[model samples]
Target chain A: MVLLEFSMSPLGKGESVSKYVSRSLDIIDKSGVDYRLNPMGTVLEGEWDEVMAVVKKCYMRMRKDCNRVSCSIKIDYRKGPKGRLSSKVSSVESQLKRKLKV
Target chain B: MVLLEFSMSPLGKGESVSKYVSRSLDIIDKSGVDYRLNPMGTVLEGEWDEVMAVVKKCYMRMRKDCNRVSCSIKIDYRKGPKGRLSSKVSSVESQLKRKLKV
Candidate 1:
């Protein structure tokens, strides 16, 4: 399984961007993928192709209206394991003996 | 200051991608931006334009040879303060009362 976390935004869209972010979230919600949104970015877990397709769709959606789009993605590809979205943090928290500020 | 963590790789380049990663790192290093390389991605701390320019350079370089390229970027834009690349982790470490496995 692969855990992909990404953030995409359009440049020159002014300081407030919740409108654009909301649009992207709508696409992600409709994709039916397991995802968790954090302050920095959204984490999605699934097959590589499915996950990437979602990102591609979101980028396309953003690109349609904006001239310059900026996207940042981070992928953690691991074999034989799934659900690293929470597990990874739990593992670290277990060592730290407390909950982390997510 | 903005803290940008990004990972870029060329798809269909087989498993080991140290060569491409090294090339991108060379560009980032030459850009003279303060950055730290971790297992997941590289965190760069600098002005928004400067940091993003480095990422653009890396993406363009990867696009030169590879037909398909994948990049993930997470950005934290804060009004004031620098050195978040280490200080962010250090803040958590301080609360955890120990060093983290960076």
Candidate 2:
């Protein structure tokens, strides 16, 4: 999974992030890709390349038309089935195995 | 001062925050408001109403045209000049005065 965030100077009027996000969604929809956008102003979940491509285009369009740009992206590995919950299993298992051996 | 952050679902393709930020700036500039948007995917500083109005409009547009929406808004009192410092200074002065009297 990848998480990306960006902030830039709102050129003349000094608007808000919500405005920018809405515009980008339109572009992504037109480009034909599967993704989910949350109301919290965050874009989450999608295939890597496709998502990146969409964001890049949107970022470019916004930047070209605005002044100053800043962005951040994070990608984390996702495990299958109980993906988030299982990471804890490893530590629990190790502790259990040690106790059993003792 | 007000600080606002919105993370939403990007409708069709999952995009990053940078894509959204660039777009807002343009609207702000055209609208004629004074504000600054930071690169950390945060919109900071601006006249109260203008910033809020722009964000609301932008947010609605994104939500109406997109799948989901989530946003966070924060308003803080900017201490003039910081005008006052919270730390060793005030206490130090008190201590010094006491010691001098002693």
Candidate 3:
């Protein structure tokens, strides 16, 4: 499974980006892929192409109105592992000997 | 190399998390490892242990003062390759036939 976390924002769109972000999330919601939206960014779980397609759509959506957009993406492409979204955190929590709410 | 993108926020600490995040960044800045600070989260680049240590320190730092802390971490562990920070985006831009400022 491949997990992607990304943050995209429009330049000169001011501080609050909830409206634009919601529009992007709307696209993701319709993509039929599993995802989680956090305060920092959105985590997408799927194949590499599936995830990147969503990101591309989001960037295009923001670019329609905003002149410049900044996107930061971190990808975890695990070849033979699935259900890593929660397992990754479990690994960390096990190491720390504490349970995380994430 | 391992690239970790994570956002940590103290729950019930109000809307702004810059202060708490600054403390976390201070720990990272002193870790002698390469890192980047963005609006959404911080990216740390290093070995697995090195990156996780910084995250542990940040979590502990926030846990000291805040009862509940939410941390969202996305890790990209690439083996036998380096300088992925820029290259990853380059690959995407190449596929899209457009350049991204990130």
Candidate 4:
């Protein structure tokens, strides 16, 4: 599962996140990789190689076209027996459990 | 780094994918989990815990509130030297390279 999150000024304000997402989505669509974007509309998918190449393209396009741009990419591991949790959270119930235990 | 791809019928079509995405985004936001959604508005983020529980919630909510629901999830590893690639593609240049190399 290769997940890429690129946050930057869009190349064209008239340009859409969906369009950029589609750039990646097009790869995913053909790769038969199951994927969908976020609401603010970034791209996410599962693949086994060279996901950063796509991110690099996004950066290049945005840099060449957008006025100002900054982006970061995060890739994670989620499979097998340990796929249950995303992380430890600050939930009230969890907090209570910890505090009560303490 | 954990990647989760959930392609399920959303809870409320009239409610909006952004809304459901926002729910996950809310958790992500609090977790400092950086994420953005797809254009159609699904959720994507980076985290290192039990993400499936969240998906479980979405499923439960959609099942109760929406008409019908189906969901599939994908998780992968992309956070190391190997993270550089998503996968091999059937590109012309790559094919050309193969044939030329041969």
Candidate 5:
């Protein structure tokens, strides 16, 4: 499975870009990829096509309304099973042996 | 100031939930606030009202199309100036003095 972490926002969109970010997310929603929203970016878990396609669509959609868009992406592609979404966090928590406070 | 990290999704969606998540993000975008998109959840930086307002809107908007929605939220409220977004991460990086790979 491929795990992708990414943030996309339009440049010169003022102090807050939640509105534009929301539109980009619409594209991701229609792409049919499993995703978890995070504090920094959204984590997408799927095959290469499913994950990259969503990222590509988000960038494309943002371009229509905003002149410049900034995207930060980090991808972890593994040739193994799925369900790493929760498992990865669980593993880290297990090592700490304490529930994450937040 | 207030910092919020959250994930919102519709229950009973298939394995992939990009679409629903995207819709939720739309509400967040319209909210006039500062935010960062992360791998686990989107982080919003603002006063209590601004931050929570966005969360409230996202939850409300998502309920329109999704029968059941799940949300995870974490907040860090501090009495200080703005700009914790990069500073928080930068502080950690400074401690290690090693650049984050991704």
Candidate 6:
């Protein structure tokens, strides 16, 4: 199983970055894995080297002090079955019968 | 402007997904948006809506035949600049005093 959506920021660092994206979401919530934080980016499952070692430790904690960093990664390697992050959006809202703003 | 990186896949489509991925790439190529495809995902640079529209089209394309689809997206919105796709990496390499594996 693999999901691994990612987003990193720090170019010039002036534009309200939510305090460096809350310090890389506090290092991906202490790297416990099985994450999902929407609004585009931050979804991790497991395996694939434990979600790429938690995205290389959130890009070495935003490359420490932020000189110019911008990371955007996306991976979706599937095998048999595992939680496809809310069952792949409930199978497209059960074929578009309703509910999708997730 | 924004940098969007996303990946989508059809579940149970039998492991090798290059065919589906190729289809999506074709769509992206035709959209005339600046993009870079990497091993992890495709990076697109454009206005937020422009990039997102491309992603939506890809999802719709995959949803046509695949019963279950999974999409992972990440966006980095920045102001006062553009062309972060290659520049971002070059900046890092410059600081590292060595080239990175792209």
TM-score of each: 0.54, 0.34, 0.52, 0.31, 0.52, 0.58
Compute DockQ for each candidate against the true complex: 0.05, 0.03, 0.04, 0.04, 0.06, 0.04
Pairs clashing within candidate 1:
A72-B72, A72-B73, A73-B72, A73-B73, A74-B72
Compute the lDDT of residue B49 as modeled in candidate 5: 82
Q: How far out, in Å, is residue A25 in model 2?
A: 1.5
**Runs in model 6 lying further than 4 Å from the true structure:** A1-102
| Winning model by TM-score | 6
Query: Using lDDT as the measure, what is the rank order of every candidate, best first?
Result: 1, 6, 3, 5, 2, 4
Q: Could you say which candidate leads in lDDT? A: 1
For every model shown, the clashing-pair count is: 5, 31, 0, 30, 16, 0
Residue pairs with colliding backbones in model 6 are none
Q: Name model 2 segments beyond 4 Å from true.
A: A1-13, A79-102, B1-102
Residues B28-100 of candidate 3 have per-residue lDDT tens digits of: 7678877655434567778999989999999988999899998888776667565655555445445545543
lDDT tens readout by residue for model 6, A1-102:
888777777889786655676566667766788776543356788889998998888888788888889887766777867687676654544544444333
The sequence of per-residue lDDT tens digits that candidate 5 reaches over residues A1-102 is: 888878787889886665665565556655678776543556889998888888988888888878988877766666789987776654434554544322
Q: How much lDDT does each candidate structure score? A: 0.74, 0.43, 0.72, 0.42, 0.69, 0.72
> How many pairs of residues collide in model 1?
5
Candidate 6 per-residue lDDT over residues B16-95, each given as its tens digit: 66678777777887799988654445778899889999999999999999999988776677786786776665454454
Across residues A1-102, which tens digit of lDDT does each residue of candidate 1 receive? 998878788899886555676677778867998776544456788999999999999999998899988887877888867767667655544554554334
List, residue by residue over B1-102, the lDDT tens digit for candidate 4: 455545455644753343444444444334443332332223433553655666666666556666865565555434533211122122322333331100
> B98 in model 2: Cα distance from truth in Å?
69
Candidate with the greatest DockQ versus the true structure: 5
lDDT of 3 at A56: 96
Please give the distance, in angstroms, between residue A20's alpha carbon in candidate 4 and its true position after superposition.
18
Better of 1 and 6 by TM-score: 6
Looking at candidate 4 chain B, the ten consecutive residues that score lowest on lDDT are: B82-91
